[model samples]
Target: MIRIVILLVTLVIGSVANINAQSKYEQGMGKAFALWTENKPFEASNVFERIAEVESEEWLPHYYIAMINALNSFGVTDKEKLTLQLEKAKKHIEEAELISPNNPEIIIIKATINTAWIAYDGATYGMTLSMKNAELYKKAFELAPDNPRVVLSKAEWDMGSARYFGQSIEPYCKDIERSLELFATFKAESTMHPSWGKDRAKEVLKQCKG
Candidate 1:
């Protein structure tokens, strides 16, 4: 009887610990997502890292860290630095992918990496870079069909890339058009708590449309 009583106590303690951990996970994700939407990715990354510590099995934190690294992949000319950044980003992304191979966010991170590569390559080969950018954006869209943020992010990148087009008005105009379209689409679907993509999308649209 004493052994059975001990077993019951252990089970009760385990259940309570699991509940507490789950609550922390949920709260962490909520805060992380809020930070992400507000363009506070550095803060979000920290929160996500904390979440990973508490729940190592969760994939979102690792994925977000990879994304933050990928987004910061500009002006890094040193091959060694670029390689290290990519490897660091890949390490977290691969860890997440192993946990959830079909995750839409993981696919988006892959697309972001592709974008970073193009950003690193810059204007040396305009057409090739544009083609690669378009391919990555399209793939992200296909993988996350309902994810308006993917479309919006593509639009932002297009506008950002246009500044380097030098005397070419075509690319700039195309980017503006794409940004407007994406923002409009996101606005139409704002009911789902479109997270950080909505306001950012609208801000970009206003810039381009004006």
Candidate 2:
């Protein structure tokens, strides 16, 4: 009877520890995201890198590092700086993939990284990077046909191609509209989950309408 009582107490303690860890993770992620949304990519990346190191089992931290770097690469004009950022983004995305293989969100991040690279220097990389980007997008879509984040990623890619590579925007307008609809109904599984991309989707929709 004493042994059973001790076991029950241990279980309760373990459960409490697990809940505390989750709460801490969520709070850290919230601060990191606030920095990111405030246009502080370097600060946000630092926070995310720390989270990724501490929470090695969680893939979201690594994914955010890649996503932030990729987004920042768009606004960077220095060739060397852009290359460095892209390399870091690739490394983080690769790590995230190792942690969560075949995950739809991770796949989209991989695609986004490649898309950003191609956008930065498509003239030099030519069709190879473009082909790989398309392949990754196709793989992600196959993995999660109804995922709102996937839809948003694909729509953003389409719009980017139109803006930078002179591709027609008409075909992607429907996709942008669909992504907006998807975003409206999307709900993240948890605070630490991938809850971004909706606001970006709204911006894309506006651009499409314009």
Question: For this target, which candidate reaches the highest TM-score against the unseen true structure?
Answer: 2
Q: Tens digit of lDDT per residue, candidate 2, span 1-210?
A: 223223322322222222223478777777776665555667978998998989998888888788767766774669899889889999999999999999988887787667666667777774788778778888888998778778767766666667677777778878767876886887766655665555556666777677
- For candidate 1, the C-alpha RMSD (Å) to the true structure equals 14.2
**Clash pairs, model 2 backbone:** none
Q: Candidate 1, residues 94-113: lDDT per residue as tens digits?
A: 88888887665576676666
* Root-mean-square deviation per candidate: 14.2, 12.8
Candidate 2: residue 88 Cα off by (Å): 1.2
Total clashing pairs for each candidate: 0, 0
lDDT agreement with native, every candidate: 0.59, 0.71
Cα misplacement distance, residue 199 of candidate 1 (Å): 2.3
**Model 1 global lDDT (CA atoms, 0 to 1):** 0.59
Which ranges in model 1 have alpha carbons more than 4 Å from their true place? 1-56, 77-79, 123-133, 157-194
